[model samples]
Target: MPKDQLLRLQALEAAERRMKIWTIPLQTPNNRGAFLRRFIERVSDRNLHTAVPAQNQSAVQKAAQFYQSCSLVYTTGGERELSTVRRLLADFGVFWPRLSNASNLLRICFAMSAVLDWAPVILFSLARPGHIVVTPAPFYAFLLGRRRAMLSSSNDGREYKSYFSHMVDTFRRQEPSSDVLSYYELLAMESQIVPALQQAYTAADGGIIKNGTLDDILNLAGEAIPRSKWDDELGKNFKSAIPNDTTALRFVIENVFFFAEFFALMDNLSESQLAYYVGWTAVQGLSLFTKPAVINFYYPSRSQALQGHVMACGALSHHYMGLAFYANYIREEFSAHELADVIALVNHVRKFFREGFSSSGALKEFIDKSQQSLDQNAPFPSAASAPLSFVTDSQEGQLNELFRHFPDQKPSIFDNIQSVAVARRMTRADTRAANFRWNGKVRLYYLTDDKRFELLPTALEPPFYSAEAPPAVKYGALGAEIGDAMAALVSMWLRDADENTRAKVYTEALCRHNRPVIPVETATTQVPSWPNISRRELAERVVSLNAAFRAFLDATDGGNQYRLDGYESLTGKRMFFIIWCMAQCGASYGKQKCHDPLRLFRYFARAFECKVGSVMSTIRECT
Candidate 1:
């Protein structure tokens, strides 16, 4: 009787006429009326439903009345009738919960169901026969469902609307596709995923819904596509008639091989695998907090400053996962078969990283170079033989190009700090210092300063020094010792938390670097002829001056901002930036040849909480 309910019904009717999507009889009679009358008399609020007159009617009319009334109910409280009412309403083609209240996952299921239901028509309309949708969830879902007959279908052998219907009917019914992540499963996993992965499983198992099964489901999802099925076929697609140097053919085969093997390795039962997966997932999730995904900013323009930060976090996650795989391979004692697979994956990633460091626009350069590199017959490089390949000239060039864009006037640390700064949340200076370690020019910002944490001179110049230079030598010795201490602290903290804890402990620890450290030599500088700038006075000036000259030092220090902005807002963007910066710093400092590997590893690992290891949750900080 009310204008809105009538309009909704009219709209559904009109949609049926134009789209011919579905139809439902518009009436129901007395048995439903008794249920409705009984339900309505109990409601204290009269305006809850459109004014459906309580009267004697046909079964279809009464059913329609009941459906409309049930649809209007927002949520199920303690009422026992609500379940029965919802089931009946669903049968009448009112499947959605209230439009505003529907979860995002539900919307996805609905849309996917529509697509699956209409797949035959869709296929006919398309000119291309092999087109695939690129959305992460839908693609994953389609693969998940079709790979296994998880749900019955009607639209051709491929349609899947019924699954969606089942998914939404209740929460527990939304299970992982015996093949991709389902909404219900994602929700279940997310609710229980602690930093401590094992504990998370225990917690989930203890709950009404089963937990800790995400890994099993995720692992099983990949198993649906077996290596035997795709191996020879993928190889034959790229085999050239050429004998020795078929670079193009080799690249394709190798990548396909790498992806498949790596996918399997990701499912391994090794301790490293557990740590790596949990940490990687944590990094991905943490990105949401620092970036917020709300603001619309261009990547190289307004958002350039944040780009490295984001990439740093993302890359670190990848790097750690890669390391975990490496460590697991090492732990297993490197048999020939395992080594072959490990080498292939390492080459794939190294190939990817090398392409980045190669040229002006590395991404563009990579697309062209990769095609060429893949054709070659040479075996892909390993950690031992492929140092040049992994951290290649091209990636270095790209990093330099990226770092050059940060304005070169002086050594200021916070040029783009404003993007992350929120009210009362000025970026703690330590964030900038932490971020600098990841900017790829570690020696420039750190080496010349004696690792003393003092602010840089307002007048620093370019091409500070090579790793082979005298200053770097000094840094290698002393910085290594300090770095060791840092790592020990991080390893212990990470091991102790439940699997679900955010890696925030690492973030908080790195902030300590913001407070400048005093060298023992400077403890008693007594310059009687000159006013002594107390160490505290010196540190304050360093922080303030870095903030002051952020725009000028873009070249010497790369485009990193030394100023204290965006520290408070702590958006996902900043989190990504900070975490990434830390990763770069770790990789740079932790490189095998640079300093004492054990010491350097412990130092940055502590700072980063060794978030990259496999099941070795905590690598001791070299204290």
Candidate 2:
């Protein structure tokens, strides 16, 4: 074993005794397969263990008749276990050519099994109460590490030690990664679990391990408890309570079952071939343990040196990286005058936002008197409505406060994880210090509930931002972004009203400014819903939104004062409108759904000289 893995196990063993908290058995490599035998090993999947239900039996049996001649296994394969395996695959309509490697065939069977069984497995995992470890294969190495820790119990220690040792030995024969993220990029997921699970599930007075809080389970796994996970409603909105009874909760897991459905495709493989599937999964999961040169073949140029340009940018962007990256960005792009102008510009935007365009009565959102700007130097991150109700309102002081306990270790997988864990803990502890976004906190980064915004210093750079650029260029990009944010603020300010009223507030606020209503739509094409409003309301809503900004644009020419003629051929009004239109130009198409609504903005109608009832021009009012 490498020194690092060796030491890691040794350290875990040593540390387990010093802590007064509970511990699990020493995890050793040798015991991998034993737990599989111990687990009730049943999965919720219907296809894997249950016969085809009557409803589906007709179709399955019908399909089974056509492929009967293929034979389950070839005459040439080994006889020791071939008969039993062949019969199993044949029932599922998984016939093999008489000529193939055992493991490959088993893998095909595993995949078929998985397709039939994914739902029950996912359900079992989501709702189950005991030993809910998610993985493709058994985690015997973890068991070995657990056994080495040797948690004390007056009666169980000796038995646990023996069991743990045996499990470790079995695991060494074939082991799996603790967990893996199959997310396009392969990242070996490391967890500090088990103890948390034991605490949550096991009875303190020594009863059966039956239940625990959902929050505790997620926390132990270093994951946040999203509101939807416990949802009893339409799986989106969060429920405040968890029900312990049968009506509220569904599946129960008394033992570990391979969520074999995901792997059922591998069933065509021979027993040895099946090991290769697990072996490859382990390889992907443990690739980090392999040399970086080998790992980089799969993922090139992803991770970087701890203090390089990429990391510096990442550190600046991530809450864990704190103000260091911001400082680095400032140093690179900011001059003394540039810094001052940026600050002035920030306060300038804030002042304009706080005090209204025409009159300050526009936005009445309950937020801080002043918000601090920490120039997200890169492609910026979003902000919450409450806006860092946590950070101090200063760029310099907030940076210092942001990184107070940020661990000062060289970049390594272990240190990075530890740093994040500490930073997350700090979010709950020193929240009064400075606002940190990336900690394991709420569901999203930028929320639209309250009044809040952050500064994106990168927006001030070229070709997006340049101090020397013409007003058309600047406003066309960054200025338009500011305008968009203003629009978002208008939308957010109305959020306090009841949902319907909120929609009315946006439309009314837009039309109330009386810049130029797009005139309500006459005929309708397919426009996507805007949260609560109907299609007609959304058109009026967009026009109304532009009305307030129209007033802002009308008040200025080339950003100096509004003029009918902008620069040369384009008028100031035209430039402001064009820049605003161009700034909001991206959308996504997915699942036969397209959500690009920017074309509906009246600017396009006016630009194209549409009279009315055209694609860009609407005749319907929001009311």
Candidate 3:
């Protein structure tokens, strides 16, 4: 080799040696402390110093020179240094893998570098379902730096950089779309390519009612954009031309105000309280997003109505996932103050929304309408409202009244739920039925008592009703009514009731219900029994099955494929529904049975369109 080549090889070899030496496990009291001590010692002795050619050093050498004077251990303390590195690793993708010993410097560097390589995946991972990624100021700041670096480079990869840069910018501004649902600002403003909506809204002097920015107006004003303003010729020229759902929009307006009030009230909460608020807030988001679809039974089942409910439900589910992430992150680090804040916020939100629940809204509306009709011997209200074209005068007055009552104190989750329940109720009301009119305040009172019964764990099988039959009216009209109440009660229990109260309700609803039940597991049946399944196992199975079916349908059916082959769709739909219910299981099961086997089989039946008459028979005869 030439002299220069020999020198370059020697330098490379030396650098590799140093990398290996740095990662060697230090025998110190704490793993972090050991690393810090080594880093300090190396810095003190200037051991990291590299003698590169003065005139023609490579890019790596230039970068190294820039870092040389800085403390390899930049923070004031060892713990801080370890934490910083760990966060960077977590953010990049090199999360702390389970290991017993400290890694060598080469291994650590390799891991960190791999994490850097997978940064995109890591960022997207933050958007996982039922998880909320809390981007603290420091984390966002770090991302901003990374974004700047990415932007500076003009490679094709810069598009990805731009995408991620947008995400980081949104995070800093507290408008992360990874968790957006009801918030219009979050959906509209966070996009990199989307036009600046807030500026546009302000510029037009409220002339245009943009669909993308609808959430902003509702949040700012406790009403939808006035039709007079939105109906302007210029408004038609802008992006607000889409026909928005008046009912949902009204609900959003009311609830946004409620949320704002609740948040303001919670500003004084302790750290722990805040943490709980974070968790509960996510749960609330889940409930809200899923509320529309879940409450469809009460609606007249029109296509547009169904679509609105489903879309809203999905958006809520997505937001909840984000909240879950935040909750999981903060659970470990929450202080007493945060805990206090969480509890306070939960209580506050719950209290605030009680009125909405008590009103003629949601399930209560269904109940109220039905009861009144029965009182007068009239038919159930089936006529759908005219697309809820706009919020009624009454809603505007109510919102104004609420604002007056809690001018300083914002409404909480309870208030929002109440608003949603009320809004949904409005969507279902019989405008002409004097008997169905409910003018009283709405309250969510529970029918709780000490009772337990073994629920079938699954809905009843055929002879009870073939898969082709419409969903069994087994819960008769009255029973169905009670079941709706039970669902609402159970949801509320998960939110505000005690574990025992929840357990009591679950036991009664499942165990004591008036129905012949099929055993979840077969003991002396014709077919061999599946192994006993844990709740965790069950959850995994359901998620896997849903994913599989979703994939299959996406592949076969034009992405949104899934025709109701009569009740065939019901089987698969029921399976996913079970998964949904199980996801929010809470203390409902109470050790009665895992209910996994039945759920799994049901999912399979739905996916494959298998007839389960014999299976149902076997389940019934198991005992």
Candidate 4:
């Protein structure tokens, strides 16, 4: 054989060997407690690095050098330049999935290079969803490296270099929080904007009202953006480069409309009410840091294990060591048969959504569109993986063997946090070196993305799923939740035109509820409201719809019916409803109703009261 062909064959075999080191046997079958004891004994400073067998240790160590040749990159949606990060990762054969301008990416590059072994999961944050503004200094510094493989022997490297050079310029002095500014600026500029709007309206009406007065109302909002520094901060990267470019700003405005809407509500609030809003919100964020004070501030009645500062600390510690406990949780609560059952349940639910959950009614047309939207989520392909398993199996503790939980009261909280920071950096470096190859497996707990779902072991706990659970109980609890998430995925599948048509259908549905009671409810309300006053019950309807689907798959024709189990002397349908309601009943009423003008729904009221003609009640059939 030719020497070149022989060398290539050796490299291919070497790569396969390294891949095997990434995974190892975990857990001892039927001896979960003993397995955990042995597992904890294996904790060490190095975790994922132990994947290699003793015989191949030297070879594995040499192969890990491949991580050294590549660079990792990340910039946010705020930057509007995924190309910067894209090229960096591509240098090492890690190709990112495509994303539209509207889509967001959560790119994490786990570095495996020798220099920064401590850098665990280097992640990217964006301005999407509930993201708040933070200094982009860290992100800026993270992007300062060349990513192309040192000796790719690639066909062309010039274009790649050019992309990198341009990206460097873009990252320079690039304020990451610029996108956040565009969103909140309108609120800060409200005083100027409202007058301008009033003047425009008056001018359009041929001076119908004089001097920017709409019925003598001088309107404004929100404490002038927390100090006169609004323009300098907001102007750093907003609408300045393109000079009057409002495209990115408009997107932020549309997506974060509710933020401004809430600010507008300040007009209706009293001083104390305003204090309550600002004070509690500030406390909630700060509570994690000063948990003891927060616990003490609450009444004595609130003294539960989950209420105290200790509990807050406990939760974080538990998460830091979760993988160590994952095996035990699986052994104690999960089984292979049960896990298979849940997988089957998930598949069944997915199939139901694909078929529009077997609908037939005015809602059916929208359901069909939703299913299509779900099937073809764009900019990236969708595939399901078994992130969860029911615990019918164990071999030997693998990943947990590498983990060491923090010593209690040893490192100060700040020190612990800093250590985590280092670990995360190392993890991200390793992941980057390993690259973004999806091997059809995911970790148990992770933030969800547009492309996939991650099911955790904790999800198997009571009320969600159980090995002994009837199908009805399973569907009523975790099944509903999984179904709800699936429905959300399907909703994204909607075409723009179909979305408008569905909106019209919903508009007409709510129109039937436009009774005289709405105005009375509005006056008693405390926020400057948007329209859609009659749609307050839509949430309840959604909850009802999930219940209906759970009890009998095709409620329209009763194609699949759950037989009665006689729980609480109730039939199958009522048992399912009761279980579902009781599961949600644990939340405090304040949590339910806050930010929602329509009172927190009383589950029993909806399930039993049969309010006038409302659909929330069990009495209102799916049709």
Candidate 5:
């Protein structure tokens, strides 16, 4: 290797070592799964060793039993579970190898109903007050490889096809019929369908047909699915929610072209082939709960090896029994002091934004308006105050209540999954009524419709925010996160503003910096090329970071008392930047792009007092 290449490799190795020190927080095993594991252990201890009051124990014990059953099914996948799956499919009028000579429309409805809760085989509909939005399901990408990209990599396609073929053969061995289709034929069909689905989904306008009617859908679908059959299926599924007497009902096809192409393809296939395809979809949906042989066919050993049974089961439980798991987890793990501190930090960051934008010249009016919108819509109820009042609580509770009707011990995991799906369908109306969605992951997000910010409860835990941490650490980690959210809000305003106003804000906020000259190989070591952050994005990042740093100084009273003990040479301001860098380090490991914002603002350089025109001081062209 060349001398320059050797140097670059050494620099990359050194950078990796430095990053590991900062990424300590992210190294915790199954951080998100901790709550579930604790709850499960507590429930087990109560059941085996001690007696808890009956009334208090019901919900938690039921949740524990349900989770255990799901875990057992997932870990000990066998023929019994596969037989249970076949029976459940038969319940939905789906028989493998040969389906009854039902009309295509009826067969489609039956197939859709079978996996309605588990997967949307082709398309799924979401009902609104006077309209419904129908779109292609996400399951296609899971079953077939993301063909647009994977198909280009012939090696990946071949491997995926081989895995898929093995999966088909595994299922075929269980059936006595000789009519099972060859996997190659199925792959060819999938290749044609996947790209068309992708194209329809990603089209410029999304192939949306606004304010359409059932007749309009039939027209788009042509003879593939008739109007009468479609209407009957809709009425059966929706019941009184959509009245037969009303003609005011509207439909929105999220991708009309997908339906046109999908129905056309269905029309081309014989009943036997269509039956086989629909059966394959059902298998794909249940594969997770089937025998380990089938489950591991698609998931490689490396991926499976990363998580143990407890963590894996917890993850699956979270997905299938989300509301019960989330409510229980929040009730068990939420901390009031931590939430209060986070709320205070968020408020401080908001104040920083308000002050900064008030004097931002051309951008002031637009930002103020956006901020006003946020203020008018109050923040979501803090999980600490009301654990069950998150945006989706009521609806989730109603759906969760359905599981209470099931027997204490389900015979099979597939049965439990089917029960959950049935419950979901029963409460589909509540889903349609909901206008806001809530995700409890460890992140902050803006709800556009609600015009308010939500901080997931998990984000208030250690390394992100803790009541015991020093003011500098709190501001460095959580305060910087709040700053990012606020900056995104400003970015949204800029996106919607007139071209002239946007140009003015960009010009006013721009920070010009000199680029440091380095060996090209060393410069590109972390990434193939520098991340392409737009001018507007760079400006927002600068403003947000400076605001956060200013807020930190205010909160700490411009004192240096919060310095780290081990790093006695580092000043308070330097420690603040270090903690902030550490908080973001996990996402940016091996990539220099994450450092661009700080480097552009020269805060890192200023904090460390790096020499002017040095690489740390002058790198990056602009902010």
Candidate 6:
């Protein structure tokens, strides 16, 4: 090789090393845990060089201390602290032993308390603006273990029952109580609930129950519980008085079956039995904050020494203190210049979609309809601002207030976690709610109601994006992401169009061809048959990839100007497609093999000069 090529190879190696520093460790399960631990430690480090506002410093410190306390409690907490937690449960009338004295209302209160502590135990959970969403209970799913296996027909429920029994035995040992239900009875109750939960979890998106009001939900739930009880519990949860007329409050019921099954079970089971089940679920929720033995019980074969502690603590912190972690992360990792570049790139992509759709005679009507919706929706205040911005001062102030209630003197991990939960519950009724939703994730999402996009801070980091990368590479990765979001918005608009308009657009943009079959081994029962890509999905992928490719060409003067250091053998166009394919590599299992959009892009064929009638070129059916 020439000296110039060798020098380029050296540069590529250094870049790969830096990328591996973040990406390679995530390939294996154990290394993934260690990576997360290191990440949390860096986020929690007090000596961060970034300048956080003095007012926000206390909030960041409290958030860090909260994670530290959870780690310490998980590793070193003893029976005394565990006993206090048990007493705390008793105070809420959540007794382990079957206590006949606990009333139906008391059981409801216990479940509500658990919800306030961010460990909801009910089928329907509270959402923003006082909405209640009927969905699967994640707490129950955690107890079942292996969600996919538990939901499969082959699962006999024996493994989950055994796991439940072990959990009960572990908790029972912490505080011995008499008259507790036999593990068999508990398993039977769970069996009845699991089927309904599974139904909700597996319900098809098209089968979504339309949005209704609280009154509609109560009617669907039947007369199992009186309306007064619901009104009282909901009012308490929302921290406001629910009016006699609750038709104004929205209820997003995704699955009606789950609510029906849940209420029927509630009506039939005895009060004492309900209390025992609810208490058990609550105790399991607090298992993370309990002794090492309780925490380790869930890990089983996995090493519990350092990796487990970090993983558990890191997960719990993210779940409970997401906003604080996000604030700290952006302060330390993200730069203003990178944010500006991303914002400009996203705006460019948006402009491309706008102009392309408006100019196309076939899509003109669709764009007109979408433009009307956008004007009417008048984007949410947060969405109206730049898509890629940091957490606001108001958001940080609310976070500080959330942590202010926790005692400075080291409180038990349970106490600290519960305090944060209570604070969140208290502020749920406020008009200016904290904008912590999806701020910590590494993805871009489109808000349909707001007609805007929001890109989280983490998506700007390595593997997905880098400020130093050439325009072609950046467009290949983040540009494609932006295009995908825009495509989704187009699909949403198309879905709302009149039947004639949709049919016309589909007839023009989508053409069906016989999909080739891929052979699978007979023994692989775990793999389900892959469905043919829908016309809408194919259309979206085409629109996304084409828009991204066009944007790249426009940005780099028809893809002739930009080049990667070691990839000089390839043109910018080829590098663009290659990096787009490489970005999704190893992101999922078996998905890329079956559902990769690249195989359907005609541009992919043209970029690499594939022969006619080949798999890549044959995608002309869709194009």
* All candidates: CA RMSD (Å): 29.0, 24.6, 29.1, 21.9, 10.0, 7.0
Model 1 ranges off by over 4 Å:
1-184, 190-225, 236-623
Q: Write the residue-wise lDDT of candidate 6 on 350-415 in tens digits.
A: 556555545456665554454454443233233235565444532566666755644441335777
Question: Which candidate leads the pack in TM-score?
Answer: 6
| Candidate 4 Cα errors over 4 Å, as ranges | 1-307, 318-332, 354-411, 425-458, 494-499, 504-568, 586-623
lDDT (10s digit) by residue, model 4, range 310-333 = 323322332233343234434444
Query: For candidate 4, which ten residues in a row score worst on lDDT?
Result: 67-76
**Total clashes for model 2:** 78
Q: Give the per-residue lDDT digits (tens) of candidate 3, residues 181-268.
A: 2223322322421122212211211222223243453344333224444323212221121233322322111123222332233234
Question: Candidate 1 vs candidate 5: which has greater TM-score?
Answer: 5
Local error of candidate 6 at residue 610 (angstroms): 4.8
Model 3 poorest ten-residue lDDT run: 434-443
Q: For model 6, what is the C-alpha lDDT against the true structure? A: 0.56
Span of ten consecutive residues with least summed lDDT in model 5: 433-442
Identify the runs in model 2 with alpha carbons over 4 angstroms from their true place: 1-292, 299-319, 339-407, 411-416, 419-450, 490-493, 509-578, 585-604, 620-623
Q: 349-368 in candidate 5: lDDT tens per residue?
A: 76776676566677666556
Sliding window of 10 residues with minimal summed lDDT for model 1: 118-127
lDDT, residue 490, candidate 5:
71
For candidate 6, list the clashing residue pairs, or say none. none
In each prediction, how many residue pairs overlap at the backbone (N, C-alpha, C within less than 3 A)? Answer: 72, 78, 42, 38, 0, 0
Backbone collision tally, model 3 = 42
Kindly list the per-residue Cα lDDT of model 1 for residues 350-401, writing each as its tens digit.
Answer: 2332332233232223223333333333445543342112122113343233
- What's the ranking of the predictions by TM-score, best on top? 6, 5, 4, 2, 3, 1
Clashing pairs in 5: none
